[model samples]
Target: MAGNWNNLQVPAGVRDLLPAEAAALRELEQELVAFFQSWGYQEVLTPTFEFVETFQAGSPAGDEGSLYKFIDREGRVLALRPEMTAPIARLVATSLRREALPLRLCYSARVFRYEEPQAGRLREFHQAGVELIGAGGVAADGEIIALAVETLLKAGLKDFRLGIGQVAVTKGVLQDLDLPREAVARIKVALAGKDLVGLERLVDEYSLTGLKRRQLELLATLHGGKEALEEARANFIQTGAAAALAGLEEVWQALTAYGLEKWLFIDLGILRDFDYYTGIVFEGYVPGLGVPVCGGGRYDGLVGQFGYPCPATGFALGLERVLMARGEGQGGGQGGYLVAGRDLAAVLRRARELRRPGVMVIIDGESQNRQEAAARAAARGLALVWVD
Candidate 1:
């Protein structure tokens, strides 16, 4: 048992991305960084671990116990960042506070969360994201949305929808209901899960009737094209909901101007999953993948909680999910020369010349006949056999 334990295995929800996966991840990061740079976004790096209180100091409810918390030598709670946006907000607030307004920053980072391990979910994951701080309104919102679409499209994912929503729509309606925090929490959870059935049951249990009932029902189905928006406004748009819809319309128009309307969608069903999202909330979904490949939205008040307020919007693209969605490339090919020669110098020289950085190269001692060399190379899936 001790020996078996010594052999080792990775913990659940954490993984070792093998060579090919690592290569693909690196390629994705480079392509995304280039894209962000082209858009005038400068890359930034933040600490992997941050003071836990810094997160709690956020404007909204933090990720809660999801943080991977630990007691450091100082007996203070420190945690692996659960997400980048908060830390980036802290960065903008403390260090870059006096820099300027509307800072365009990008980052490639590893975020940790203690969660159940499943397809598309990990305790540790890679997120390539950008943060546009000190920017507000539809134009800024539109820019983030457009950049998100371009980033994913550039990453080679064509089959996906940008599910758009305004948190205020949901927030507005919930506030109108005057429901207790517990019921609202339940409804939000159900809505986040897209469990209309559960939402309806909660509705009945809560005895919600009239506009409130209709409002919940409306949210459940408020996803699709612009037509969904029209329907939302016409039938169930509450006083506050109408204002939220108008803001959404402005962003929709901006997305149209960016020539990205086809990818645009209405997901009014979206809940205030994060309290910081005072305006737009969006997520990217691809064919056959249940988890979102990328997601973010405007959190206009988060930085202020860091003691420096700014309007900001951005999204994080998950490499593993994106790779799964694209379902292509990053595969190793069998293109190499297996050099079998008696002359060590000659064999080494030939092998060095034939070896491309990413390609495989094998050289064997003279004792191994060409046939044996060929067999060895063949075992490794190397196709070409060169005998020196």
Candidate 2:
């Protein structure tokens, strides 16, 4: 029993995808790949693991604890990639250095993060997204968000909203507070979690007054559409956040051109966990899910950390989260051939003949006759090809 238990179970925070689930995932990936390609984004792949430094350059200070690390052959540190953006940045700086300006790259791969597993959070999960390298400004940001919305729609998610924000605005507002580093960090945590009570407590602790208190409170509580952005601009215009708000305004205008206003809203409080985000950032949400289905933002500084300075922006969708949001069931319950016969070669030939793209075919020589073959096919949710 112990041996059986050991063989049958996978580690926590990871799961085995049954055939149907795997098929569904493959179909989703293919559809997304096609959609990305249609947008001039070329697919690129990277190693599942890279040197720890690669990720550290893009992740935040305390994020190191989440990396799955180990020692390498030469006694150097290595870690499975927690995300693809940094690795792709490394690739662009080294291999694709000479690639023309405005490289559009996309990838669909598994990312590992040593975090507690929850309803939508997993230590090991799949992420698919794009990197629009060497392109900066509102057009790129708008395109990335547009692509994300369409991708979710492609995945069949009907009810969702993407909240967009400018980290520059958030950072500007924080810098204007002139608070201690520790205090600022705490305020950021509270804002990111939308904990207004904690934020109020912090304001009380710091003896914040007037505009400072109002700014912090607004950052924590402000959430809505265009009116919300206008409200933010009014509150932040006199502070350091004015420029960022202007930049966000341009991006918002561009997004409006895509007719995506209904799918997006402005949330100045949307501070992504990654420290690499230097400009616009956004996260997609589905009702009833505890996590964002997808997220990413501009990291113009990420590639430059690899010694090639460039502007870039992109987003990534969590495949499992998307599937969970869409409530997709295991697919492929029918339309497969189960060829069975008395002669082995005949069954093999029939199975081969039945093979085609998107079709599943199985050979069954053990069936005694057509009746047995039919029963077997029925049991397996497949069609029978009785050959004698």
Candidate 3:
């Protein structure tokens, strides 16, 4: 009778990172950490699972049903982190209070989100992000944008653009309409998708004036280049949404002073899906990718939700997407010098001597010739280093 057994397979939306691919990812992450560290951004690691209440501080638990959750032995609900920002905010409020102003923290971790997996997207994904807490000025905003651009450049990404927008603009436009909270939420969802038809339908249902309808339509078109901002400015003046226009101008001027004007474009319609984000928001995109590889913006009120009430801004980059943008292929295999020979003792000794942290793997056999041994080593993804 056949032996009873179970198939060994990872869950859907998750896969093993093969040897060479794992190495490539490690290299990329190390490079990013080093780059961020050089800029005085100290790295921090938060727990993989946090108490459910921690994430639900600002939003209802029912709203985030996609999160993986369970009740601990203590009877407290817990969840695998779906995102890092909330946990980091809690940390700042509780542990890092005594720390100095303008605290810079960096992190690299896996975030879980229950979503349909696709190319460059996985349910379990790695994210590297930094947060600047207590800094609440355009200069700080500009600095964050500049750092993001520099980080992507260091990661071997070219032909990328930074789409910048202020949430205040979208919020302001909706506020001017005096819509109810429920209606505002629906409008936000439509705007986030860049769904012009949906937005127009909602506007019509609400009986918005011709000017209000035009303004809503214009938000979708407020993307591309400098001219877009100018057009938005003119449109806002006529519609009396001057405050939103001014916020955009502040961000634009700050970016220009930081010498990042060329890298950014105004996207008034850029609405963050998360309600936590307030003020300026930005996302980094490269050619050939439909989704943003990196995203963050001012969440000046996020910490406030955690009882800290500190203003802050941050961004997170998807490691897989960055690797794809750099054209780095998957992990190949074991990466070390391979030693093969009939004299097992000598080969073992040589391998031990060469093995420090990242050098040497021993394979012993006399049946295979030098060429055969080299072929075997290559197949195993090891570099052949012969022993005399």
Report the lDDT tens digits of candidate 3 across residue range 257-294: 77777778888787764678778888888988777899
Q: What are the RMSD figures for all models against the true structure? A: 2.9, 1.9, 3.1
**Model 1 TM:** 0.89
Candidate 2 — what's its lDDT? 0.87
Counted clashes in each candidate structure: 1, 0, 6
Writing each residue's lDDT as its tens digit, candidate 2 over 82-187 gives: 9999999999999999989899999999999888899989889999999999999878888898999999899899899999988887888899889888898998
| Candidate 3 least-lDDT 10 residues | 57-66
Residue pairs of candidate 2 with colliding backbone atoms: none
Q: What are the models' TM-scores?
A: 0.89, 0.94, 0.88
Q: Ten residues in a row with the worst lDDT in model 1?
A: 55-64
Q: Tally clashing residue pairs in candidate 3.
A: 6
Clash pairs, candidate 1, are 304-309
